[model samples]
Target: MKKLFTTDFKQRCINLMLHEQHTVAETSKIMNVSISALQRWKVQYIKEKQGITPVKPAITAEQREIQRLRTEVEQLRSDNALLKKVSAFFLDKH
Candidate 1:
């Protein structure tokens, strides 16, 4: 029998490899997934990033929402940092 993995689990594995800078071998051992599966997931992730639909393990709606929110949070943080710099500059002038 084959083991079925959840979308969230797959996403976490990809994140570990991409964001955390883990090698495929390390991710496979740590996540207990096969190297082949990790490679496939990486390909799918790249395709998705390029705006192409993946062949399998399609990203769920919830995952898409989370990604969107993460991007929004990053943008907001950048804006906040700029605002703080501007405020400090004005304070120094006055």
Candidate 2:
């Protein structure tokens, strides 16, 4: 995949495509991003541009902690399995 673009550049391109009513091809050409990529951003921009203020991402700290705990649990389970295999190998040899 191509390198990700900066937030400002992407928003600028989306604004041009949405607010200024520029064609996706023209916006992509001006912003130097792929037309398909520009189209995707335009979809999001158009959705949120409706009412007074923009809605922010809804993730909470508790949700983030839950995700972190899930990852740690997966890692610990993997480590325990490896340790069990090692212990069984030593027992079998001795």
Candidate 3:
């Protein structure tokens, strides 16, 4: 997955957390995300708004592709492992 810069993620997260009155865990769950992930985003937002350098905005397609590819790669790895085991069984003598 692409690493989000500190500021932008934080700002969006704050928007969600504050205006929505979302709990750390609840917000994360509704978004299908982890609490620590949102927490980190919150930190980055605060740090940047406090005077740190700005983070670039994320593209939806790019983020979607990142998640998709990560899942695909994992599945491919698992399939390859199974194939390797099957091949080994076929090649080995009893």
Candidate 4:
């Protein structure tokens, strides 16, 4: 059976490798996980750190605020565009 790791466990493994400056092979051996899994976790870790992916529940307050603001801005922009279209339609009908 394949072992399933929790997000916390995956993050801990990635952090151990990164913060302790351990190579992927070393980390894999120490963590008892596959080297390929470690490599993939490292890539995912970097992407999450760079905000390229939606972070898990461990996201900081600042990141949460930024995400909320971004969502609000997108919604506002969509609403503005819709209003503009409606205005244009009304004006054309007059």
Which candidate tops TM-score?
1
Model 4 lDDT on a 0 to 1 scale? 0.76
- lDDT of model 3, residue 94: 58
lDDT rank order: 1, 4, 2, 3
User: Per-residue lDDT for 57 in model 3?
Assistant: 38
Query: Which digits, one per residue and each the tens of the lDDT, describe model 4 over residues 20-45?
Result: 88888888888899988888778766
Candidate 3 per-residue lDDT, tens place, 1-94, comes to 8654443444456677867888888777676567887886666555554545333332233444555666799999999999999999988955
- The local distance difference test score of model 1 is 0.83
- How much is 63 displaced in model 4, in angstroms? 8.1
The count of residue-pair clashes in candidate 3 stands at: 0
> TM-score per candidate, in order?
0.61, 0.48, 0.44, 0.55
Worst 10 residues of 2 by lDDT: 51-60
- Cα lDDT tens digits, model 1, 1-94, are 7889888898899999999999999999999999999998888777777666544546545446656777799999999999999999999999
Clashing pairs in 1: none
The alpha-carbon deviation from the true structure for residue 57 of candidate 4, after best TM-score superposition, in angstroms, is: 9.4
Alpha-carbon error at 33 in model 1, in Å? 0.7
The per-residue C-alpha lDDT of model 4 at residue 49 equals: 70
RMSD values, in order shown = 12.2, 8.7, 11.6, 5.0
* lDDT, residue 67, model 4: 69
Off by over 4 Å in 1: 60-94
| lDDT score at residue 11, model 3, on the 0-100 scale | 49
